[model samples]
Target: MSGVASTRQQEVQRIVDSLSMAIAQHRLKPGMRLVEAQIVDVLSANRNHVQAALQRLALQHIVTIAPNRGAKVARPEAREAREVFIARRAIEHAILAGITIGKMALHNDEIEAHLQAEEVAAASEDRRHIIRELSQFHLLLANISDNRVLSEMFSNLMVRSSLIVALYQRNDTPDCQCQEHRAVITALRAGEVARAQAIMDEHLRHIEQQLELDDAPPPPITLRDALLVSW
Candidate 1:
């Protein structure tokens, strides 16, 4: 019975992860509707598992569920957007602090590879790909920090931030800057954790500063289009 239950939970988690990735990739815009029936059909997943997965996302504040409206990607309010950034600043600070100078092993090549991917995406002007890459850079740093707990916390925050950006970003505002990511890596490689932390703070603050945060209406996007790539 336990094994059966575990398998069921794993199935539910697969749905949860796919949806979360879609959200983090910016393919799933804020307030985009997620009809359970459509998702079950698109992914050929069990309706029960699909509902469970969305409930999980709701628990994480990544999605919102309404009695008759089903679920939609969360549309953070202006105040919630500001608070999300504040929370991220705290979480990311702790993640960076775990990388003490000369204590934790750092991997530059992996991050460099990620940066290269970001460059390729930028060259092609693939906005969605670029957004995914930018967010992954932070997740990469969290992994390198070697604090699994912090990594998990920051991962959730990254997705929430994605929603915040999608909803409130200024028209002229650009996606996360790769140069800033490179700077963070450079500071880390030089054993300057404090400098790296400062860069990260400035980087995040710049992104936050770019937000219009006026409760812009969430744009239109189909749930199938958002979750298709993930499946």
Candidate 2:
């Protein structure tokens, strides 16, 4: 029975991760409902498993479970959106400070690979791929920070940042600047930790500035259609 229970838990976690990735990749926009029936069909999972997965996401604040509206991707409030960036500034700054010149050199190839992928996605004009790759660049830096705890914290922030961008960013605003990413890399390569940190701070600030937090909320769209088109 215990083994059966553990297997069930793993299955639920798999669904949770899949949905989380869809949200983080921006394919699943903020305020979009997550219909359990559609998820069960899309993923070929049990209804119970789908419900458990959504509950887990709700705990993480990635999904919100209302009294009667069911689960929907969280649309963070303006205040919460500001807080996310503020938290990012502190956490990302720490990530840069913790990285020594030696560590940066060690991870150089991996970091460049992510940047190359971002460039390719941008040139191809694949908006979805571009968003995913751009987010990966920051995650790559967090991985190189060599602090597992901080890396995990940064990962959560990145996820929330994606939601914030989806909810607040202007339609015409680009989420990431490849040149700025390259500049940070150059600073790291030159062993200028402070420069790298400063550039990262500015980059994050620019991203925040692009958001139209005061804009009215977008109308809700069908979850099944979003999942079908995106998946």
Candidate 3:
């Protein structure tokens, strides 16, 4: 019984991650409805798992479920976007505490490797991959922090941040600054927790400031385009 339940849980989480990645990468645009039947077919996932996954996302505030309407990618309002950044600063502060100043940072190689990949992706100009790579940078830090609870909290925020940025961001806003990320690594390695946190604060603010929240919300895309995204 436990084995079966574990399998079911894993399947549900798989669906959730796929949807989260699609949303983060801009393939699943905000305001687009997520039809369960289509999700089941497109993901080859059972209906129950798809339903469970969507419910989990709703709990994360990454998806919205209306009374009569089905689930849709969450389109955060301007005020909500500001609140998210505020919450992000708090979470990142905790994440830094786990870094343990004066100690060698774990995942040093992985850090440099991801930074290289970020630069390459930025140069490639593949918007989907670039966005995914940039977001993964924070996820990597969460992993490095080795606090599962904090990691989960930040992961949820990170995914929601992507959605907010996609909806409210200015057309001219460039990808996250690669140089700022490098500066963060340097600060962390030097056991400069305050400096690292400061860089991260500035980095996040730069992204949020670029959002044209006064403008209209992004238009809803078709359900098919939303669900047809490949994992």
Candidate 4:
């Protein structure tokens, strides 16, 4: 019984982490169906545990579950996407401003550690993990602001924002390593607040521009039709 429970817990954690990473890296778009059986197969876990994990993600607004529809990745509206970025810019700019004036506090060692971690994750072959690490960079920015409330708010939004980024991303970058982040960090360390803010702004704008809002999705055909055509 204990072993079963342990495995269940691990499965649930794995599902959460997988989805979270997916959202962070823009590999999973908003509104993508997460069919229960498919999730079970993907996670290599039992259906029951996958269901439980889906429910947990729903609570985080990372996924939405509906009657008869089951679970799908959460899709933020266009307005929501704009709002998320707006909030991010405001908070991050403030953090930069504070740092410029020597009002903000952050540990150099911590920032260095996160940068190293980001490098590793960015270089990782696993796209999902890279996405998670990218999303986490914003969380680290929030922490540097020394406001727990802001940190928590950014954390919640990062999950949703990641989905937005994935849904909108049109161009495939060669790697997840954000040169913009590195630039921002460099400027911040040098007490160049304006430079950091500019880099951050450019980064956000580039991400926004890469989303494919006007591109039409490919037409869907029924399996029967596909089979007929193949014949």
Candidate 2's displacement at residue 40, Å, is 1.5
Per-residue lDDT of model 2, residues 1-231, tens digit only: 799999999999889878877778777888888888889998889999999999888887889999888898888998999999999999988988777778878987888788888888888776677778888888888888889999978877888898998778786335548999999888887878899999999999889888888645644556665565643
Task: Report clash pairs, candidate 4.
Answer: 25-131, 168-211
Cα lDDT, all candidates? 0.83, 0.83, 0.84, 0.69
Error of 3 at 196 (Å): 0.4
Ranked candidates, highest TM-score first: 1, 3, 2, 4
- Best by the lDDT measure: 3
Alpha carbon deviation, residue 57, candidate 3 (Å): 0.9
What are the per-model numbers of colliding residue pairs?
0, 0, 0, 2
Q: Model 4 scores what on Cα lDDT?
A: 0.69
Q: Per-residue lDDT for 113-168 in model 1, tens only? A: 89899888777676677787788888887887888888878888899998888887
The window of 10 residues in a row where model 3 has the poorest summed lDDT is 100-109
What is the TM-score of each predicted model, taking all chains together? 0.93, 0.88, 0.92, 0.64
Q: Write the per-residue lDDT of candidate 4 for residues 1-231, one digit (tens) a residue.
A: 799898779878877777666556555556667777666655567787778888988887788999997887787667777878888788778766656424323467776777787788767756556666666777777777677766666666777777776666665442454677778878877878889899989887777776765423322332223212210
Cα lDDT for residue 72, candidate 1: 85
Error of 2 at 20 (Å): 1.6
